[model samples]
Target: METLRWQDHTLYLLDQTQLPLTETYLTCTRWPAVADAIRCLAVRGAPAIGVAATYGAVLGAQKIAGETTDAAAFGDRFLAVCDALEGTRPTAVNLHWALARMRDVAAAALKTDSCTAVVGRLEAEAMRIDEADREINRRMGQFGAAELAQLGRPLTILTHCNAGALATAAFGTALGVVRALHAQGLVRMVYADETRPLLQGARLTTTELAADGIPVTLITDNMAAWTMKTKGIDAVIVGADRIAANGDTANKIGTYGVALLAAAHGIPFYVAAPVSTFDRTLEDGTGIPIEERAADEVRQCGGLATALPEISVFNPAFDVTPHEYITAIVTEHGVLHHPDSQVLHEFFRKEGI
Candidate 1:
């Protein structure tokens, strides 16, 4: 499924916040609307957010194109739009990476082209980023499937949150690997964690897998350890929001706990993500900013209150898994086994990142 679509200066996002119940799309003609979608979780996931932000930049440039003829003025306003979109979410490195690429394209185009022409360049770049993400996911799927197939049996995989086609441009990161394995008839069943605060797993992950005819069993977040212990799970794979230089990963809240469980069971805990999700500047997960969401998100489920109105809630949208707990970091380039700072550095350097 295409998470984002751009046509004639307008961007369309598959409204993820309404998934499984209502398959709706949000039309965004302006940059702020796109930013709002990202902030509101109408469009989410690291790679999908990156793709949306790029198109958001294109929309911003198109708006500037109409308001100003001067290239310098357009450049300043376009940058302000990028800044707003980047601020929508702090944890996803893909958002920052996507915006940086758009900024570079604009900076270069403004020197030799008109504001209108710069808008064209930005649009083209946005499309390229969108297409590249889908291709990257496919490659990551192949690499991860090849690595996991070594288990030498039909495998039962456990996953947290919703890292499926709905979460990316197309295919997925962790779920893409699952799809690849299933295609090879190597998958027995998929166990999905009903990610709380928002049941992305129950509402989104299972929905995606079911649509593709993949056998999936949904379980609550707390049931993960017992399930792994009794169900003979061979691997645990999840997607990342941001990966630090030391291979420490930040993903949906409760993912750290899942990693710890996978560790105790001797199951290979894998993180599947594109290279763009890596923030090489941050030496470890501590340096990665974690976005804490509204208290109501914890106090209620699906807008039905589950707690007292005045009760306090600590709701962090994501958590960091220490590098040691990760068995491997799977990427479009290759799989990094027992990833560490030095190994990651060497891997990226070899890949010319």
Candidate 2:
């Protein structure tokens, strides 16, 4: 099933924050509600949020058209809506990319005569973006699965965070790889890091795996290296929120530690994502924007306090894993081993991206 959909001019999100316990959806008829869902993590994941923002753009146009027929008025309010959605999340380059695409569509449509045509074009653009994301996830899954198969064993894989379908418009990126590998009888089981401060791995990843009948074990964020030693894990694969030109990857917090552990263990560490996740403008991850969230998220989880109310916390939503630690990056375009700017440029050139 698709994680989100557009129906009757409303964007329907699966309400991911209620996952594992509740199968619920949040419908947004207004663009601001879409931004709120993204900000609250009700609709999350890089690709999913990107798709959400695409729909948000469509909704913004629709709302403005309904409010008034004045072209200048519609243009002003619509641009403000784009600003709001763009500000919702920063770590994921996909969010910005998707919004920019929609903005381009709006700019072009505005040059023409009709408001109705503009709304229709925006909807079409959003649908096209969502469909492209799903296709990319599928291809990334296939390419990534084959890469895992090269290890030549039915492997026990460990992953950090929730990169399953719940984290995308449909299919997935990282878990999509796992699904593809499992289909070929090359997977033994999966280890999910509880993903502290959010519990996405435990709450969402395990839920997706279980629902799909993939064997998944839950472990705390601190248990990664120990789990690698004790569980005889064959590889570590995770999703990326953003990837720099030189292959530095930014993912959910604690992913760098997971990569470091994999490196030390002599286990291959892989990052699975579509080309849309790659930020070619940034030569390395140091320049990639890092988003710091609320201190309460670190001090408390599930509404249970883990520290004193006055305790200080540094809660970055993501961390960058340097390219040296990554064994390979699996993308829809195929695997790029030991990626760098020159290598990525060649890959993009070959793919005509």
Candidate 3:
């Protein structure tokens, strides 16, 4: 199933919050609606949001297509939409990267054309971005599966959060690796962590895997260590929102702890993501900003109160996993055994990335 769709100049996102029970879609015709979807996690995951924002910029351009007689004024409105979408999620570099590409496309189009032409060009670019992402994820899956084969067959894999087809254009990042292996009949089962507060793993990931007829078992966040020790997990593969120059990663909350557990248990911890997820300007994970979500997310589950209202709560959407904890990183370009600034630089140079 398509996680998102474009019809009649509107972006329709699969409402992830209502997963595992009810399936719903949110139709966004305006850029503001797109922003809200991103903020509420309706259209999440780094690559997915990047593609969404690119299309949102196209809608913004459409809104001001005939409003301005001057090209400069039209560019202003388009840039504003990009700026607004860029602010939706700070942890993911893909959001900014996509918007920057849109801006460049807009500038180049306006150099010799009208605002209406720019709108068409933006729409074309958005579609190109979406297709490119799907292809990237597919390639990443192949590369990641190969990486796991080197360690031995990954019969039992453990993953955190929802990184399946729902998380990206089609195949997922971390889940993409699983999908690739599963396609080969190599995967026996997948253990998904019921990410606390949001329960994305329980609601979205398990459902997605089950829909594909893949074996899946759900477990609570705290049960990861026990499961790993007893279940004989072969590998831990997770998605990344941002990667630092040194390979430090920012992913769904509790991933750092999961990585630690895997390392302690002698399980290889692998990260799968597109090359766009890396931020070269950031020296390390310390520079990544963590988005703190609403406290209500932790106080309730499925609209039912589970904790005292007055009790203290700390809800961060993500956490940074130190590079040292990572066994290897799989990207569409290829796999990096262990990445530091110098090695990463060499990789980019070698891959022409």
Candidate 4:
């Protein structure tokens, strides 16, 4: 029973905004609370935020389900909820993508019998999406592990940010590959970037990875270049929030910098994600919108009360990794190689998504 779940009429979320300090769980009876949670980053990461948004839509539907039970009215309220949640965070495509998919479910449900029935149907559909997300993550791990295994030897890898189970409904995308490697006895050592400001890598990524008994070394964001050059890392892997049709990726802040470093050292750079992460609408990396965070994240910094105030910091939530810099984009379907757009389009055609 993680913070993000549906039990009875309420929604549970880990309250990520208060993380690494006060462990608080926000239970939402109203759908807007869920949306607020996402906007405020009480619940975050592309997949997890998406899942929470879908559930938020379900909760939204529940709130709109009055005794009158009009299909048209229900649709109006449902769309409103989706719109509100989508506005919470524009950078993560998953937010809009999930809400839109859930909206489609609501649209179809309206054609059915009663508003109550439609609400029930929406809950069922949202639950299915949640379940499917978890399954896709598991399959993603398997596919990624298979590719990494072929590289030979127990491999030393470097990763940025936290893309583990906490970020998704399941084992995760990029970090999933590392977990899979460990499970298969192919991992040598892992170097996690202590992603500045938010410190997702240090807080959540390392916490989860260490719990799994994976040998993880935490390094500052600037230390990536040093580690990659001196540590003789064999490969670099990351998860993407949105991958354009041309194979460019938008991931956690600092990923692009890390990718550039990996390229210079001639190390293999892999982007592991589900097919859902692929955005055929966007032509390339340049088309993918990079989110600009507030200056407070870069300037003030958190956890200052317990320590000296002398340290200054700069923080951005995510960075975009160009497709050309990526050696391969591994999905559950298979490994996609160069001529990136063509390979991605082939995947789209093969899946019919």
Candidate 5:
């Protein structure tokens, strides 16, 4: 599969505000515009949001150069830009993590150089963050592949949401594992949940899998139980938006239901994500704030559905899956089983996350 690459000094982002109907790309050239896109979900996915925010920081630095003459004023403006982007989407810890790292680099640059040098340094650091995300995605895929191989050959796996190339700089998290499994001839089938309200599973994951020539079965969100019962689903893999120190994961809405069902069926439910998804600052899932989407998203059907004039909709873009439901958490660094803060903090410090 061809990996999607980010444009330098340009943000080639999916205009998610027009998804399922239009595949639009927004080229963000300024920090505020980039932050607004993320807040409005013109660009999404945990890893992708982080990448966008990193680029947004660079754009901020460029904007500062053009707007200010004082070095201190420029640095303050840059920090404010980073803060705004970091808050664009709160569920994804990666957004703040990436931006914070960028701010640190920017702060360091200010101590030893002129304004011109600072801008150049921030640009290079932003590029490093983007490149690192790609490498992490690929390596996480490799780690997840080893775990999937242990299940058996020709394995049937179920997944929810869009966690493929569209979700990250390269490869993906959970979908990356699915891709690697197919590459190794271990996956015989993939069942994609429609991921209602957003239809990321149907619109994004299924498309990517099919593009790779991997057989995919699309089913309504409620059909997961039936598919597992008749098709012998061996495992369930999902991407995490945020992972608490206790191992509880926050992902797309309905993911908790999928995990509960997977446990009932005795299927191993695994979460594949980069180390950046881990939030050591948070003790458990309870502290993670779930993003509630527009009511219309739940009340109405966007594609191929009969229209209803009046209906109340409860739409949450994501849900938290308790730690007990997760069999393992696979990262670019390694795979963790039933992890605790001790293990999580160690990895965070080791990776300087």
Candidate 6:
């Protein structure tokens, strides 16, 4: 299923908030509508968000192209669109990374082309970014499947949140590995955590896996430990929002706890993501900004309150899992076993990335 699509100068996003219940698409003709979709999570997932933002940039350019003939004026307005998209979500490095590429493309195009040419270039770049994500996820799936194959048996894997196609341009990251393993008859079952507040796992991940004909069991977030202790979980694989230079990963809120559970149970914990998720400038996860969501998100489920009206809440969209808890980081390039500052740096340098 396509998470985000661009066609005829308009963007189409599968509304994630209504997933598994209602399959609907939101058509965005303007960049502001795209931004609202991101903010409201009608379109989500780090890579998917980045891809959507690129199309939003194209839409932004298209809107202003007719009004501005001057390249300088067009560039300023385009940068504003980038800034607005970047502000939608701060934790995902891909959001910033993708916008930077868009900015660079626009800047270079403006140097020698008209505003109209700049718009065309931006559109082409957006398509390239979307296509690249699908390819990267497929490659990453292969690498992760290879790493998991070392178990030498059919594996029962546990995962948190929705890292499947719904969360990306096409194929997934953690779920990509699950699909690859399933293709080879290496996966026995997948345990999905009902990620709280948002329930992306319950609402999206399980639905995606079940639709793929993969065996998936939905479990509550609190049930993870007991399930791990009794269910013969081979490993825990998850997707990341951002990875610091030291390999500290920030993913869905309960991921850190899942990592700790995996460590306690002697099961390997894997993080599957493309290289773009890495924020090399950040020394550690401490520098990675954590986004705290609304209190009502924590207090309600399916538009019904689960807590008292006046109760206080703290809802962080993500949590960091230290490199020590992770067995390896699966990427399109390859797998990094026991990733650390030196290991991650060496991998990037050797790949000449």
> Each candidate's lDDT (Cα)?
0.94, 0.91, 0.90, 0.82, 0.84, 0.95
Report the C-alpha lDDT of model 4 over 18-103, residue by residue, as the tens digit. Answer: 66556788989888899888877778778888889988988888878864588888888789888998888766787778888898
lDDT (Cα, tens digit) per residue for candidate 1, span 1-353: 56888887789898888888888999999999999999999888999999999999988888889999998899889899999999999999999999999999999999999899898898899999999999999999999999999999999999999888888999999999999999999999999999998999998999999999999999999999999999999999999999999999999999999999998988999999999999999989999999999999989998999999899999999999999999999999999999999999999889898
lDDT of 2 by residue, 155-239 (tens): 9999999888988988899999999998898889999999998899998999989988888999998989899999999999999
Error of 6 at 105 (Å): 0.3
What are the clashing pairs of model 5?
Answer: none
- Write candidate 6's Cα lDDT for 226-320 as tens digits: 99999999999999999999999999999999999999999999999999999999999999999999999989999998999799999999999
Worst 10 residues of 1 by lDDT: 1-10
Give the TM-score of each candidate.
Answer: 0.99, 0.98, 0.98, 0.93, 0.93, 0.99
Off by over 4 Å in 5: 1-8, 16-23, 303-312, 342-353
> Which residue pairs show backbone clashes in model 6?
none
User: Which candidate leads in lDDT?
Assistant: 6
Q: Per-residue lDDT for 66-183 in model 3, tens only? A: 6775899988878888999999998989999999999999999999998888899999999999999999999999998877766556489999998778989899998999988988
Residue-pair clashes per candidate: 0, 0, 0, 7, 0, 0
Q: In angstroms, give how far residue 111 of model 5 lies from its true place.
A: 1.6
TM-score of 4: 0.93
> Residue 101 deviation, candidate 4, in Å?
1.6
Better of 3 and 4 by TM-score: 3
Tens digits of lDDT, candidate 5, 1-353: 32223566676777765655577777778888888888876677899889888888888888788877687898888888888888888799999889888888878878878777888887787778778888888898899999879866789999999888878877888988888888898889899999988788888888788878999999999999888889999999999999998898999999999999998899999999988898877889999998877666665677434346475666678899989888989999889876676667776687776
C-alpha RMSD (angstroms) for model 4: 2.6
